[model samples]
Target: MGLRRLAAGLLGAVTATVALAGCTADGRESACDSAGGIVECSPDQRSAAPKITGELLPGGTYDVANQRGQVVVVNFWGSWCAPCRAEADDLENTYQATRASGVTFLGINVQDSRDKAIAFEEGRVSYPSIFDPGSRLALAMDIPPNTIPATVVLDREGRIATVIRAAVKQEGLQPIVERIAAESPEPAGQR
Candidate 1:
């Protein structure tokens, strides 16, 4: 099927009660990003993944700071976003399936509280996520704040390999992941 048809097909099959403020192309940025408010990233998103830290959920103790030498996938979402809810399963599946390949998936729940975010995960998603309670991180990144369901793929060397600004499928994810795994680090003792 064509891209349009595939998108439509998938959209129709997915069910979500949460209200999506706006939608992006690949579910990485806020679904509602107006081309006008969206600012481009330095070195672009395909360059080195910027060094940053995010407060973890559950207890909010550990902060996921670095992405060096690992393929990190960051998904920006919120409990209020329908599309984000729709992609929850796919994201979890990707996380579980890609571990051996040295890929790590992290979620950034933009503009959401801990309770709502946790409910979303336990009820539907199985991956780990960070709660961006005050929109601080979103503002710092210069992305349109509250744009649920965006994703950023960082390469093994910590470079930004790609950004999926809308809902994405498994096929759309493999190529970049493959390339990242090719350069992934082996055990410390291994050559």
Candidate 2:
């Protein structure tokens, strides 16, 4: 009877531990739901994205926080990455289609020289890209872009709504951007 009692206690403890693993320290659900390489979070489940401010390749500064009222699509890329090159046009197309709806696209060029990165962008994309040879900005994200051609979509409230950890095509990415863009912005006073 003592052996049976111990076994029951151990099983209960294991179950509780597994359940708690999915919760944050403050008892909120931890991390976004991920499926087939795409990670998504509901508005209430989203956490604020890390501050992203940097120098643009051509010349200018950008602060993601300043784009609160717009849905922002951030892409992490490198001039030498084949996948990044392959997805460039698709990203530009999606950006053009969604920009009228208050959607903005920003790229972070990682591990590439300014001249090379600029050449890669010439005529490929209209949106501005930040010059980040060391990938500091990418590393700062809550869900860091572990891959060279990752994309993160932020809601109007500046919270991370979706993360795609691979090259994205226009057909696959446009719907996600449009869905997030459709969400109503928070009241000015609430921000």
Candidate 3:
């Protein structure tokens, strides 16, 4: 059973890497670089993020399209995941520090009851989260956050810029958020 789990985990990682390669039509090299589980894409290689609209945890509807012209950080998490709980405060701190620079953080709670997810976020994060019990939003992403605690950073133009497939620390995530936020909103000429 343990060996089967290991094999499944490896297969998932390979699949994710292939999916994220983002090769161009002309067969150009992949525009993404994966190092230490963090995948960063060059501005010219990014593709538009899929539309993500969902119900907010407590109330109201949230739409990712409305956040154009801002660097958006989308986190996929579940209340039952230990790593999700461990990174909650760090995610919140990074959001608070980068919001002034046009960065916003959105959480997608997956595979958990509304009550538990809401309880988990009570004092840990100030930003609103979408209730995604079925992971519909995750499936819609260009680079899906397949792992709990994964984070995808969208550039100002709502393009996938970076994906971190592990629980993040404020120190590491804040810099990436700030850098992407500093990029110009003008679309790059190269595809």
Candidate with better lDDT, 1 vs 2? 2
Cα lDDT tens digits, model 1, 109-140, are 77788888888778666657776777565544
Ranking by lDDT: 2, 3, 1
Candidate 1 scores a C-alpha RMSD against the true structure in Å of 12.5
Candidate 1, run of 10 with poorest lDDT: 15-24
In model 1, where do residues sit more than 4 Å from their true spots? 1-45, 142-146, 184-191
- lDDT score of residue 131 within candidate 1: 69
**Residue 85, candidate 3: alpha-carbon lDDT:** 93
What's the CA error at residue 58 for candidate 2, in Å? 1.0
Clashing pairs in 2: none
lDDT of 2: 0.87
- Candidate 1, position 14, lDDT: 62
CA displacement after TM-score superposition, residue 15 of candidate 3 (Å) = 8.2
lDDT of 2 at 156: 88
